[model samples]
Target: MTKRTNYSKEFKEYVTKLVVLDGRRIVDISEELDIPYDTLQKWVASYKTKQKEAEDNRQNALLSASEYKDLYEDERRRKLELEEEVAILKKAMHIFTLEKN
Candidate 1:
């Protein structure tokens, strides 16, 4: 029966950061740290998953912001068009009232 060695959370995170942030080789780190290569590899893979999810969330928020901006601009243009139409109608009413006087 083999007993498992427990690694601290901070140690695992630091090891993962070496790969995610420093772009260091996992095998080299594993050998240097005297940890099994598979363990280091799994830690880095987990960090990559979280990184990907964060990137995806940022992308989705950016897309929604752009869509909102486009919708606002469309509404602004429509409002301006309606204002001009109303001004024309008011001026025509004034002209007719003058002719009747």
Candidate 2:
């Protein structure tokens, strides 16, 4: 009997991304990753299905135009604030990582 192998969630996600986002052939990825062809195909299908379902739900749950505009404005403001915070953190990290002469 062959031993069953288990993959981590991050590995599975990376595999799915390679096939779904990178538009790579399942056969090629399967051979390169040393994973079973059918297993990789099923993982890609599941990822695509989830993406489609999320898109469908998002389209179905649309709000009024004005509501969307208001929500968009609020989200845009929050995004800008987060980006500023991230820039500050990156600068702080750069300072911390610098070598002292």
Off by over 4 Å in 2: 64-101
Report the C-alpha lDDT of model 1 over 5-92, residue by residue, as the tens digit. 8999998999899888998998889889888888888888888999999999998777477788999999999999999999999999
The superposed Cα distance between candidate 1 and the true structure at residue 100, in angstroms, equals: 31
Provide the clashing-pair count of each candidate structure. 0, 0
- Report how far off residue 82 is in candidate 2 (Å): 34
Worst 10 residues of 1 by lDDT: 59-68
Predicted candidate 2 versus true structure: per-residue lDDT over 14-44, tens digit per residue: 9999999998999999999899999998899
Whose lDDT is greatest here? 2
Per-model TM-score, in order, reads 0.61, 0.61
Alpha-carbon shift of residue 37 in model 2 (angstroms):
0.3
Deviating ranges (above 4 Å) for candidate 1:
1-3, 64-66, 74-101
